[model samples]
Target: MKSVTVKNLIDLFKLEVLIGNEHIGRVITRSRAHRPGLEFVGYFDFFPMERVQVLGKKEINYLHKLTEEERNHHIGNIVKYHPPCFVVAANQEGLKYLMKYCEQEGIPLLRTAEPTTEFINKLDMYLIQALAPEMAIHGVCVNVSGIGILLRGKSGIGKSETAHTLIHRGHRLVADDVVTLKKLGPNTLLGTHNESTREFLALRSIGLVNVVRLYGRKAFQEQSRIVLDIELTHWKDQALNNDLELEPKFSDYLDVRIPYIEIQLQPGRDVASLIEAAANNWYLKQQGYSAAEEFMKRLQNE
Candidate 1:
């Protein structure tokens, strides 16, 4: 449901607005662009009206080959469909008639200096980032050994405290209290700090601290790809007696399942070290080395 206006595109691309100043608010619901070559020849059966129509050199040349009446009729039908906007790439001239139609129909007409393919690629990338699905979660996200590790637990479970310690140990903190996660692709989730608390971290003893200033800019990251999830829980005597070796677990967020682990927080246990080790272990697992699996294989062979 995410959408961006033609004005947003203009601002992002710095395009020249040839017409339809009043209709720059047209919504662009799709990230893809259409050439409309067939539609230009008076075929509109499968025209994608929601996409931004991109008029390249070939389409413009084809329009020039037609007679005045033929050109207007075909172009008129295209405008009648109410496309989001028309972007004339390569800064191609001889678009006066098309601009006139856009002005008459109140459809925004934009011009870009870049070639058609390059402009389309840039616009698609921008739209994809702008329209990605996002959600905020109550947790701490940090870059541990180049792996984005998310710490989740109840209030006062030391999520922020562990993040603080990790930052001191040279790991970058992405978000402390609220982690905003965006799904960029089918299996990719990007994590970033909430704008309100981007460079700040909250702690019980010291009210609020600026991590960037305290630990330098290297101690913070604007965003990172989430790869692991670590949940903290209070220690129980019975739980400690369970199997020491466990299979890998996964947690789902935005339909992407991330490698997951649970650590027990106890009075004397070093939570920061445990989390750091967990991150390193996760990295090793990604590299195809699993200590637990190897040990299990050894037991089977014996």
Candidate 2:
């Protein structure tokens, strides 16, 4: 099963490890975090014990209000359920029973500098990516003129060449040669670089080029939500749509439908410029303006 370790969280977020050093290696199978508001009041119905537990000012203050016996009883209830860890957000200190009970029960306790909501949001984003279903495809993912575009084609095609042109034209490259895509939710697919070949892009003539070192940080982005997938096909194929308009095209990835298109590659056809135009047109359509639709309407009026 896909899982992330508690140690990974500590290293990823620079969390201060308080107790349960040996338990730091414990695995967290769930992607969401839980704030134990009801659990603190001795209600444990359907509580997700495997998720990371977060305690903030509201929860901490509530626990502090209870008497020693009442507090320990509630804390023991939470600890016995065996949560992955308890993170005290906003850099809180002096968590007496909460700290002691976790240590005694061998549950990992952690602290973070961010506020409750902020830390949870950041942590959840990472968790979703870490645990989400991921697959690597032989394609390039780029941010072309503010739109995320995935270029796909067979080997020796112009994918790399077109991506290099877009990057040289001040657009950002998310990943080259191979892009790892993660399904974030029902409608979101995030594209990112693989750890092995992150900062490099391949050019047939020059081999692998360090894009960031050569073009600086402005040439790369950590990730992008893929909005369009464009497949480059040979001109003579005639099997794909060449003049698709007046309606949208779509394809599925991990059961989620993404806008898809096909661009033909032939002599005298500037595939790079075509890609840029596609990206720009996609952005315009997103803003409720379709150049193709407007042209059709003009023809009807004429």
For model 2, what is the C-alpha lDDT against the true structure?
0.89
Residues 58-105, candidate 1: write the lDDT tens digits. Answer: 999999999999999999999988999999999889888898899888
* Model 2 alpha-carbon drift over 4 Å, by segment: 237-247
Candidate 2: minimum summed lDDT over ten consecutive residues — where?
Answer: 238-247
Model 2 residue 10 distance off true place after TM-score fit, in angstroms: 1.6
- For each candidate in turn, the TM-score is 0.86, 0.92
lDDT of each: 0.90, 0.89
For this target, which candidate reaches the highest lDDT against the unseen true structure?
A: 1
Candidate 2 structure quality by residue, lDDT tens digits, 1-302? 78999999999999998888889999998998999998887778889998999999999888878899999898888898889999999988778677799998889999998999999999998899899998889999999877888999998898988888888989998998889989989999989999788878999999999889989999998889999999998887645553537357898888779888888888999888888888888888878997767888999999
